[model samples]
Target chain A: MIVAKRKPFDEIMEMLEEYKKVLVVGCGTCVAVCLVGGEKEANILATELEMARKLADNPIEVDSVTLERQCDREYLAELDDKQTDYDALISMACGVGIQFLAERFPDKPVFPAVDTAGLAVNQAVGWYEERCRSCQQCVLAWTGGICPVTMCAKGLYNGPCGGTNLGNCEIDPDQPCAWYLIHERLAKQGRLHHIKQIYEAVGWRDTMPRTLIQPGYKKPEKEEAK
Target chain B: MSTDNGLKSGSNLEKILKAGHFAFTGELGPPRGTGAKEVIEKAQHLKGNVDSVNITDNQTAVVRMASWAASLLLVQEGLEPNFQMVCRDRNRLAMQADILGVYTHGVKNMLCLSGDHAKFGDHPDAKGVFDIDSMQLIAMVKQMRDEGKFLGGAEIEHPPKIFIGAASNPFAVPHEWRVHRLAKKIEAGVDFIQTQCIYNMERFRQFIKEANDMGLTEKCFILAGVTPMKSVGMAKYMKNKVPGMDVPDEIIERLQGAGKGKVAEEGIKIACEQIEEFKEMKGVAGVHLMAIEWEHKVPEIAERAGVLPRPTVE
Candidate 1:
């Protein structure tokens, strides 16, 4: 799931300083699962913003609403009935949802309240770790299901570099070396031959802004203009 | 030295090793800022004392003058540079472009490495571009040179003539697999190999013996890396702080035994001893003396190690 963290309170306050009234928006999907931008978080942020502004002698009005999923237009249509008196909209969703909300309400200024981290797995209630970079090309079959692109600090494509020490990364002793893990897993599975093959250089499909059209979703060319 | 048809790039280091001489090489790290004076001064120490000097590309991930540019500076100063290229900074296109560029400027040798992660360097926030690992980089260079083709299989009108080298770390984890890794590097078309700094002679000896058993030594020249520990503090730091560095407790104890005033001298003596031993070790072709930041001491170290008056080959 996509993971995000709330932006620093000071930065969020600074962005909303000019607005007299604001609406704090949240998503109910990935961000909610990660305990970052759920309805509870949005209400807490709204209360904190009201109290902080009242104390600064600049009292302002703030409201918050949590939608099912901000990325879908159908869920976003539920906001049409809400009063549109807000000077700015504060998005508490991931980057994609924030952009979608901005596009839906093009007139109101939209400020991001959370920084989208990456595609990750929830390790615990409050802890999460990145699992994939969505590099557009995956080599998991050869690497024993370990993603070197995300786990290794250098994102090495071949074997481990000289920095692998005692199965840990040179960057930090706590972080396990991705290649070392791959080697051990492959060795146990009797698939060591997979790593021996020289994997070619990554083509970097993610280098540009990527747009994927699924097989059935791509528009057909207009019948060749009969 | 008999002239053989097997000389790949005809680099000075390659020629010396191919001539059956116990070759000696040194390292010169480019400065963080743009200044040729430092590079020149450093090269002066290694001018006639070693076969060729390795110009590091942002060693430890710190920003520095490009290695190719520094290599050109060495070429201008009448010295051969083992131009180091790290996968941390460049994609294949940039790497191939620089290889061609450096060759035109008279640089001959190239060292492929997966550079230290950028998080450990000055620019911790910089994006690391490991589009290819060191193994892939070595294979790509071999393709460019031997096959006369780019990585994309396009014909190169004139490819860079490079003596390829890669780094080995026998002290890294899964010690049993180190020799296999060396064999893989040999298969990838590496002409020579320089290992990480060796303070744990026991493990390194075992690694060399395994390589010998696997017949990997016959395929490529193995240059053992040595760095003189400046002080006991540095020894402890390397043993504790630096990952993949196997500074055995015995070496640190030896450094401490040399009273505080004589630790540096003891460090030099230890390095010289390692070099002397490498000369007699089977399958060991050379010694890569890396006096980190203490380039001025290289000449003395090389002379004391009895590798002075480096050989010249046509």
Candidate 2:
């Protein structure tokens, strides 16, 4: 799932420096799952913003709404009041949600309140570890389930670099060397021979920012003269 | 143009190795900060005493003057440098560019190493980019030389003709697998390998014996590494702390028994003894003396070990 973290209090305040009244919109999908932007968080943030403004003697009103998803227009339609009473909107969703909301309400200033980190899996409560780089081309089958593109510090496709010490990366001891894990995994499956072949350098053309258009999915042009 | 000795246009070390001479290579670590004064001085101490000097690429992952720049400085000092390039800092883009850059500056011999992790060095916060493993790097350079092409097969106007080198660790765990790994690197087009420091002769002997059984000795030069222990503390640190390094208990005990100020001398003696025995070991080519920061000891140790007065290839 996509993982994101809330911006620090000071940075959020800086984004709201020029505004007095604000509407905080939260996403109920990824941001909610990652425990950053949800109905509860949106309410808490509203209270915190009120207190921050009160402490500064610059009193301001804040209201919030949790949309089913900030990315979907249907969910965004829930906030179609067209009431431009607020000075700005603080989106507590991923960058996609923030941009989509901005496009829907073109007149109001929309700002992101969180940084979209990466695709990750939850290791435990309050901890989300990055698992994939979304390189668009997956080599998991060949590597025995270990993702060197994201796990290895150098993103090497071949075997471990010489600096792999004690099965831990030389750069960070906490992280296991990706190739080491791959070797162990491959060895376990009796597919160790696959580790020997020299792999070709990865091409980033299709993966740089991957997008897809399925067959027969494109909108067809109007039929001209038969 | 080739030198008068009719060796390659690049490294004198390459010429020496090609001529079937026992090569004695030492390592020179570039200073952490700018200013080449310290590196140049160290090179001067090793000049003429060893065939070629390897300028480390941020040895132990601590940042230093760029290895290429240090290599160029050594070249200016009239010393052939076996430049060591690590994959930890740059991706394939910068790596390929630096290979060409080093070749243009007259570097002839190059070693590909997976650099030590950044956490072991001063900059623990920095991220590491292991874009390509050492094995792939060897193949990449070999391709650049043999086919005059990049990793993606784009032709270069002038290809870098470098003698490729890689590192080997016989002491690391899963010892039986190391020889095969060396074979893989050899298959990838490596010409020579410098093993991790040898304090465990028994393990190293087994490694070489297995390597010979696989007939890997004929394919590449095996330069056994020997770093003399400066103190028992260093020995303990290497044995317990350093990864892929093995300092046998006997050696550590021997260092502890060295008594007072004699540990350093005892360490040198042990290193000299290993060099002496390694010269007679079958399939062993020569000794790679890595006196690390103690660069001054290289000449004296080389002299005592009888690999002194490096061969003149021309």
Top model number, TM-score: 1
Give the least accurate 10-residue stretch of model 1 chain A, judged by summed lDDT: A217-226
Clashing pairs in 1: none
lDDT per residue as tens, model 2, B176-240? 56887898899998888998999999999999999999999999999999999999999999887
Candidate that scores best on DockQ? 1
Q: Model 2 scores what on Cα lDDT?
A: 0.85
Error of 1 at B137 (Å): 1.4
Minimum summed lDDT over a 10-residue window in model 1 chain B is located at B1-10
Fnat across every predicted model, in order: 0.84, 0.43
Off by over 4 Å in 2: A80-83, A205-208, A219-226, B1-10
For candidate 1, lDDT tens digit of each residue in B1-314? 11246767778888899899998999999998888998999999999999999999999888899999999999999999999999989888999999999988888899999999999999999899888889989999999989889999999987777899999999988887788788888888899999999999999999999999989999999999999999999999989888889998999999999996999999999999999999999999999989999999998998899997898987
Q: What lDDT does the true structure give each of the candidates?
A: 0.91, 0.85
